[model samples]
Target: MAFLGFESKVFMAPMAGITDAPWRTILAACGAGNLISEMAAINAIQRKNPKSWQIANVKDEPYPVVVQLVGNNPELFADAAKLVTDLGAYSIDINMGCPVKKIVNNHAGSALMCDLPLAAQIIEATIKATPLKVSVKFRKGWDNEHINAVEFAKMCENSGASYITVHGRTRAQGYAGVADWNIIGEVKSAVKIPVVGNGDIDSPQKAEQMLQQYEVDGVMLGRAMLGNPWLLHRTHHYLQTGEILSEPNASQIRQMLLKHLHLLVNYYGEHSGMAISRKHIGWYVKSMYDAKRFREQYTKLNTLSAAQDLINEYFLRIEA
Candidate 1:
């Protein structure tokens, strides 16, 4: 991320269905340098998947956004890149790291790891088709049977990708065990393009550790920032000033959740908006006292007003 000359080091990884415009816009305000949209299926985009179409909209996005696309076929993947570039993405990211059954079974995602030549071809086609900058996200390899991130990073660089992001886990590892920062360090050493290190970065200290230990250009946070966009700003501050910032208090957390709800309603209409808002609110309250009670009450909220009223009541009690 920083190697892309990003002013901020904290970046939000693309999470399907969860990292939409409303969420990206919110994260952007919290000092996230980049926002990556969830991976859109190449077939879906080529066939004009209405759901994918809605998710790819970058018209009113707050800052430079990179849309990630995934598929096995080089032709379809190339077409999808062209489509998103026409939609005004700041950049395009190819997904070679997804380990899902559908994605892998289709010979895409981590499946591409089995064939480096084909993976290189996909990168070539993507670079040829789009005017936008190209980047790649991938696991170390299909498994320990073939760990070749350094060579793969070279392939991406040869194909004209601006950068590479390594997750530091083999496809076999899934999200299971620890991410080998040493592997990320290896990939960084092997490539001229910037390497963005992403794995289980849960806090600013861990982010600093990634920079110091791995020598990566930047860090990407996926699940760790679930209900805490403030992590981005805190991470940026820690990197620059070497100081830790206080976590948001209950009242402030409530306010941020409410602001998110408002954005969701503005973006996705009220009925569906309130329903989706509950999930995020649930994540926010999970670490608080009486979390079970909060989730139980919050789930029953069918309207925005009902949910906001309950949230206000909960925060008032804490503030008092």
Candidate 2:
């Protein structure tokens, strides 16, 4: 459970295009025990793709950073793992849980699940390439007809992976149906290494349930943490104590949103930062009254000051 020096059991999953430096910084501040960098392609990193390099950046984060790499080639995986290790990654995570079409088509991501030998090869190569702890994140199977998570997890453990994380859905499910926590439990029973259960853990209660029901060493949060980093802290607290903490109030939510915007702007310049902040703003207010109208108006605004004014106005109206 202490892989890569992480003492806390709650982790933030590596979400492509979402779990960037700014967001990871926010989540770490909110008490995430460990953070995974957005998934970067091995080929892109080897080619020195600027955006891929940017995606692997984990500067200024307080917690341990795990750089997740996706690829089919063992040599490329080793090269990419070394790159991230030089960048100060605390550990390297192999991506076999991503079900995106482009990634799978390239023989990466969940596609690796169908070819267990190659998956083990990539894990072994990466582990040999760096002293950093190497881990693997994978799904239950290629589909419901092919549930191989237990077999695949044992292979990964045998190939020198320090830990394993299982997302309770098959590749065909693709975020559509409920995650089968039973499969996660099965994998946990099969592996001696730490197993982290992922998928459908959107709340503190569900997180606690995953630990109890599945008997996992930890839980990983993905979409659930979007615009709601407080989930990490709350889940941690709930697991430590039997009491549930109150949700963030209106003022607290507004303040956090503003802080997120500033961090985005500081990391990315105003033009691109404000463009991305719109989506985050939408996530933050999705449950608010008149949210649809507010999102429509908010997305059209161009300047940071204008966006700030509108957020203030919207919250004032909510208070009224």
Q: What C-alpha lDDT do the candidate models reach, one value each?
A: 0.86, 0.88
Which regions of candidate 2 are displaced past 4 Å? 1-4
Clashing pairs in 2: none
lDDT of 1 by residue, 255-284 (tens): 899999999998889988888887888788
Q: Cα miss at 18, model 1 (Å)?
A: 1.6
Global Cα lDDT for candidate 1: 0.86
**Number of backbone-clashing residue pairs for each candidate, in the order shown:** 0, 0
Provide the lowest-lDDT 10-residue window in model 2.
1-10
TM-score of 1: 0.95
